[model samples]
Target: MTTENLLVELFVEELPPKALKKLGESFASQLFEGLKSRGLVGADETVTSYASPRRLAVHVCNVFATAPDQEIKKKLMPVSIALGADGKPTEAFKKSAAKAGCADLIEKWPNAEDGPDQLYVANDGKADAIFLRSMAKGTSLLVGLEGALEDAMAKLPIPKVMTYQLEDGWTTVNFVRPVHGLVALHGADVVPISVLGLEAGRMTQGHRFEARVDPVALTNADCYALQMADEGAVIANFAERRAEIVRQLQAATAPLGLKPVEDDALLDEVTALVERPNVLVGKFEEAFLEVPQECLILTMKANQKYFPLLDAAGKLTNQFLIVSNISPDDASAVIGGNERVVRPRLADAKFFFDQDRKKTLESRVSGLAKVVYHNKLGTQGERSNKVELIAVGIAAMLGNEKLESAVGTAAKLAKADLLTDMVGEFPELQGTMGRYYAQHDGLSDDIAFAIEDHYKPRFAGDELPRNDVGVCVALADKLETLVGLFGIGEKPTGDKDPFALRRHALGVIRMLIERDLPLNLDALLFVAAGIRGFSEDVAGQVETFVFERLSGMLREQGYSAQEVDAVVSLKPQRLGEIPKRLAAVRAFADLPEAPALAAANKRVGNILKKAEGEMGTDVAPDRLVEAAEKALFASVNEIAPQADAAFESGDYTASLQALAALKAPVDAFFDSVMVNTDDPALKANRLALLNQLHRTMNRVADLSRLAA
Candidate 1:
């Protein structure tokens, strides 16, 4: 067998910039996997992916020219059906052998000793069957590569497909972009494959305009990247190009004592838009700075794919960096072209900003009525009212009338930005624009920031609200969306979260746990449910959904399943207390008596559950006849007050530590005394004692969950 490195490239029109990275990775991996599965490549072979604005390619090392031949077994039929009692071929056997194209081989099987290798009897699970053994021919590189190419193309994650006619003008093909050429080479020889109506060749275009040669010709798989760079003026590797852009951006900005805005998404998109990156600085008029820096920076990054520079104080500068595909001498034209292009975009943003400030947020509050929030949940105006009510109630619970007034005003104006021209133009600036407009209306910073911060912690790991009023409004807004949506049976199923309900639920969880707010979870859900007049059961369902999200979050934070189960099984109302409780549970588990105590606790719970009547925690001391039971009762009496006091003082660790003293007595009582005694009075007293012991041990967390 002979092995050689292989290379494949698809030359096409520009690919979708946002999807280029994934497209390249998927194409390379899928092609490599396809070859490996067919035994044409070894497990340790290396693969490199190349993606540019106009090409997708891959290079695989140590690929075999043909897969090795394999031995195959084909089951014929049961032995009973193949041969008669005297061991002669039956009619059924002849028909099956004829259909298998082995009738001539089967005729000599009984007497010819050399034909033994062709047919044999083997158990095919249920019965002994006659099997035909044969050798399969190896797959040549040409056929295998064709199948692999077809498989890779079929599995591409194309965002959209385009239908275009080939050069013949009669045949059409569907692809992400119109394909002009394909290069498939095994070593120096073309592997002869066709895809998307294009034939394999060594010639490929490069850089559109900056290439030193008209058509770059690759020599071998190993030299493809080097030749492309030297002759085509293009960097073929996606990651390499991105790193070069990053390096150039740093070099361009370092001398100015500033840095480009660090956004990986913007960097990737810009990297995908060009093949040979040349970083250059461009500037806009100082008058555009009057508009909010967010609007200016967003327009530059989102619309023009430019990297906006920021000063040392984190303020947007007048100059931004451009990643041009061509590096020309005296590059003033490229710089001037970009600057001229961005001036109108900035002017449009400034116009929208100026127009939005004319009407106050309070004045626009009524305009939200015309905007439909959800078909089932009335309009944005109605949703705003619900959020305001929940916010005011939360503020009152936290304390102070001034805070309640601020939260109510913030909630009312939060959705007012939806009606603004600036926000309507850029929906990402919804909360951001509200803050500016609120400040423009001569409102206090508290109200202004709250109106903006109400949407804080919008995604995972995002910052929470900055002020107390913002906290209340944020929680109220998220809870209203959660409960209202769940009430309408729009719950997320699997990955189909159209409304991002899971994100909303997680936001609520983060605020509650991170802020350590004293509000109860159930009570807050009830307040959020009140606006829609939803039933209590709906609120309970929302609570369960929130706890599920919290449980997953805790596990991700490195807590064990048992530890999380112990704490969350109680459904503690105050989510803020969970961290302290988990810490206490962890500390209790480290004690020497923890294992025995957890087991005893589990036993006690099972006994209490099985008892006929309701078992009260009140233990009658006189009825404690056994010495072990009496000692256990005394231990519980002594430990209960200490644990209860520590729990009240918020020292959960001390509360759990106090229960370690009862382990010995509890173990001895369970060892000697039967909880279900013959005498009814004795049994009742024992059950009550065990009930008290269970309650004292599980205050911080359910100890029974840790029994395993």
Candidate 2:
């Protein structure tokens, strides 16, 4: 085997900026694996992926020019069908061997065991079979590379395919964009392969406006990136290009004691849009700052792909940074061009803001009737009414009149911004514009913030609502969405949550737990369900769905599966208490008596489940006949009150620890006493006693779930 570095490139029209990173990664990895599977590359070799606006390429080191030969085995007919009664070859054996290209072995017979093509008898697990062994030739680079290229191109994660004809115009090919060239090289030699109607070559075009050469010619496999940069004026690697953009941004902003807005996604998009980046400063009139900084920043970044600068206080500045693809001695025209384009966009935002405040959020409340939230669930107005009811109920549970009033008002006006011009233009600013408009309407800061913060913690690790009223409204809003959608049987299936029901459920869970709200989960669901006239079964399904999300969250936080199952199995109403319960379970598991008690608890549960009719926890004193049963009853009587006291005081750890004293009695009772006795009275008493034990042991968590 001989080894050398290899390079593969596909030149096409400008690729989708959002998908360039993934497309590059997929192409490189799939191509590498394809060659490795064919034994043309070592498993430990390194691969470098390069992606830009117009190309996706990969470089692999130490790839073999020829794969190693392999030994192959072929199974012929079974022994019974191939051999005669005296263990001699029959006519069937002769025909099979000749067809297998081993006819020489048929004539050689007994002497064929030592040749390149040999015959042997082996059992294939059903019956005896004859096998022929041969050597397979190695694959050359030209053949292996062609197969690898096809596999790689077939598996590219193209977001959307475009169909275009080649120069020959009769045949059409589909790709992310029109293919122009393909480059495949091993060392200094072209491997000579064709893909997507283009033949492999060393020639590839460079920057459209600033390349030193018309078509840069690569000299070797290892110099593709450097040569492209030096002669073609293009930074061929995506990560390297992104790093250069970051460096220029920092250099451009450091002199004024300002920083560019930090958004990885925006930075990646800009990096994909440019080949060679030149950072320049551009500015708009300071009057545009009268609009909300979020609106201006969004317009500039989203529409123009410019990096907005911010002062040390995190306030937006009038100056912004532009990443130009071409560098000229006089860059005034480019800077002016960008500034001219952004002013109209900012003016539109300011216009929407000025016009939306002309009417109060309360006035727009009636407009929600025209917007259908869901066909089965009525309009947004109806949804807001449901949320208002749920919020008041939650506030009443908290026993605060002021909070209840604020929650009701905020819930009514939360969705009013859906009809506002600012939000209509930028749907991402729904709750945001509500806050601004509420402030302009002479509302208090608490109410205004609540209107904005109701959609807090929208995604994972996001901030929760700030004030108590915000908490109530946020909970109410999420619960309404969950209950309403679930009532219509539009639950999330698999990964397709078109309505983001899972996010709503998780948001509800976070508020209940993080705020340590003193509301019962079932009661809250019931309140929302009642408002929508939903059945009890819908409430139950929503509850299960919420708890499933909570279970996954707890596991992700590093709790063991057994510990989480033990606590979640009980369906504790106050989700705020879950952390304390899990901590107590972990502490109880560390005790020396934990395993025995858990096992004994499991045994008692199984025994009581098999008893006739319903078992009561009323154990009569006179019916406790056996010594083991009597001792167990006595121990339960002593420990029950202490455990109940600790549990009532919110000391779950002490409560679970109190049950450790019952371990010995529980074990001895199970060992010496049989739960099912011939005497009806004794069996009934034992069943009642075990029921009492099971109930007492499970107050904190289901201990049986901890059993192996």
Q: Model 1: what TM-score?
A: 0.94
Estimate every model's Cα lDDT from 0 to 1: 0.91, 0.92
Q: lDDT per residue, candidate 2, 452-559, as tens digits?
A: 999988999999989988898999999999999999989999999999998999999999898888889999999899998998788899999999999999999999
Tell me each candidate's TM-score: 0.94, 0.95
Q: What lDDT would candidate 2 get against the real structure?
A: 0.92
Worst 10-residue stretch by lDDT in candidate 1? Answer: 109-118
Task: Tell me model 1's lDDT, rounded to 2 decimals.
Answer: 0.91
Write out the backbone clash pairs for model 2. Answer: none
In terms of TM-score, how similar is model 2 to the real structure? 0.95
Put down candidate 1 lDDT per residue, 1-708, tens digits, no spaces.
889999999998999999999999999999999898787999988999999999999999989899997777899899999999999888999899889877887778674225324777789999998888776777888889889988998899999989999998899888899989999999999988887778898999878889998798898888988988999999999999999999999999999999999999999999899999999999999999999999999999989999999999999989999999999988999999999999999999999999998899999999889989999999999999999999999999998899998898999999999999888889999989999999999989999899889998888889999999899999999999999999999999988999888888888888888999999999999988887789888899999999999999999999999999999999998999999999999999999988888998898889898999888888887898889999988888889999999999999999999988998898789789988989998899888888888888888999999997
